[model samples]
Target: MYIDSHVHTSFSGDSDTPPEKQIEQAISLGMPVLYITDHQDFDCPPGVPEFTFETEPYFRKLRELKEQFRDRIELRIGVELGLQTNIPTDLTAYASGHPFDFIIGSTHVCCGMDPYYPEFYENRPEEEAYRSYFEYELENIKAYDCFDVAGHLDYVVRYGPNKNTFYSYEKYKELFDEILKTLIAKGKGIECNTAGFKAGLNHPHPTEEILKRYRELGGEILTLGSDAHQTVHLAYHFSAIGDLLKSCGFRYYTVFKDRKPEFLPL
Candidate 1:
């Protein structure tokens, strides 16, 4: 059974896919498990309202889908929390009250800028930008303890301006190793986001070498996601990832329920 651990619906603010459409897409794709991890970044910049869990209609819709589709597919109510090290109280309060099946902690901001726009990296040195992004991610990972998994370990590389520039684990060995070690120490899984390939990067987020190193460091818990924003992107190229994971020594891909992880053989 295929499981898509990260996806966005209209609740994410940036996506247009409604909850029902997301469910229908999952069903059509033959994905047995779907986690609607609509983005919940609370401190969005000016003109961008924060996506709150308190949004009653969205949560209500999720509840409805969970019940309606329970027999057709295993629906998981999930959230992808955008992490900022400066606001632990806000993060804690937002997460504490939710009854989530999965929680994905992510760092979408780098050096006070969201890198979604091309202008974010306009004149900056690629290495400096990459380094700062990694540092910010590490900070977020350390600050948030309630999440089940760390989403897209090397997401920053996707928009590096200089696409196809190979970034090896050996190049950032110390920092990359620290990330894997921290995730293992904190008992959180790392998501193998396949969207990097769609983003013009040759490697997946965190790369195969990094995954191999993570396994070498005794990191076992791993999850997979397409980071799909559109229906056509669901489970995008996951079969290739299944082979990559097995080659990297990972025997299982994790699924979450009641915020607890369950291992499924690859």
Candidate 2:
């Protein structure tokens, strides 16, 4: 099974699943690596749920569990950092101060509002909202250099009114190409998040076409994640990932340890 690089436990604001339950599920599934990348979005705007966690307790609990299950699995500590245009220093400070094995830089907030909330798409066309989201993402990555990989590059689409029913890579080719080029130039990576299937979409977070374009642009550091918040969701829909990656021209998938990438045969 592919390593689940984006997972959440009780420490996250949106999840209540205990960390041990997630660990036990990964072990039961025979997944060699379990990355506990809970949410850590700082300075959330009004009306958005607070996504921050206490670092000391989070680290203490995970470190204890990591040692306790050392022989059974390789449990890695990771954080899903919420990338914002205004908080580059906060992100850099948090990343530099921690010893996390992996960091999934995510754009959860866009233009002072969250796309998950209905108001973000209230007054504007869905296409405009999506464009604003992409613009926010581009500004973020260009402003900061603290993360290893970009998570859910097309996350805003999942909650759109149409939800990919009319979406295509060609619809926004220029912006998408720039995003891919910038990531490749920064030596960063992107992930194939399976949560899209759970969100009622036919494909992953980034459509298959985007994945192909990333590969065509010489982006090699691709990772796979469930973006799961519950035990049943751990490694969600991973059984088909190998074939999908092969079709995307990926010979291998990535795993991170100590902030370094290791490619494994697909």
Candidate 3:
């Protein structure tokens, strides 16, 4: 069955689409399994909006939905954590105790600021900004060490004024290699985020070059996600994604349940 491992619902601070609407769209699209990974950034950057949700209430709603849609589609609850410098131990404890099917560790805020803003790029060249983002990513992952996968390796480049114009895996090969190496050594995975294609970037979030490099580095346990914030984007660009992954030498993809990996043949 085709699975979209990264998704969001109304529970996420940025999304307003109802949770059931998201599931209905997936079922209409013939997707048998999907995950709802709401955002939870404990310590958001200054001026950036905080993304925090009550776990018990969120899960309670999801549990009700799971029962309501039991025969229509298999729904899983997960969280996308924006990894920062100071990760709360209680946050880890909450996840450890709660039932999360998957968790994505992402670097949305770097150097106490969000790259999505214009000020984040002020007085800093894209190269330095991108480098600092990756540096923060590496540091955060090394310290947090609790997530299941890296959200988007090259996400920083997505917001640049040039916007991948001068971007390539080779340009940042050294740091990219280290990042992939660290994830592999730590038994973590990554995702093929399809949001970039919709943003007119004409590539996945990490780009094809990085995905191929991850394969070259013996990195498996990859998953497919649209990073959708609404129903219209539930499984965006999946048709082309299959061919893309095959060309990159991926024979299979992955899904998670109860925080354990499950492989599915391509």
Backbone clashes per model, in order?
A: 0, 0, 0
Q: Score every model by TM-score.
A: 0.94, 0.98, 0.97
Q: Candidate 1 at residue 24, lDDT?
A: 90
> RMSD, model 2, all Cα superposed?
0.9
State the TM-score for model 1. Answer: 0.94
* Colliding residue pairs in candidate 2: none
* lDDT (10s digit) by residue, model 3, range 83-158: 8877444556666888899999888888778888877788978888888888888898787677899997788888
After superposing candidate 1, which stretches have Cα over 4 Å from the reference?
47-53, 164-166
What local lDDT does model 3 show for residue 220? 94
In terms of lDDT, the poorest run of 10 residues in model 3 is: 86-95
lDDT of 1 by residue, 225-251 (tens): 889888888888887888889999999
lDDT of 2 by residue, 123-230 (tens): 889899999998888888887788999999999999999989888889989988999999999999999999999999989989999999999999999999999999
TM-score of 3: 0.97
Cα shift from native, residue 111, model 1 (Å): 1.3
Ranked by lDDT, top first: 2, 3, 1
Q: Pairs clashing in candidate 3? A: none
lDDT of each: 0.82, 0.93, 0.87
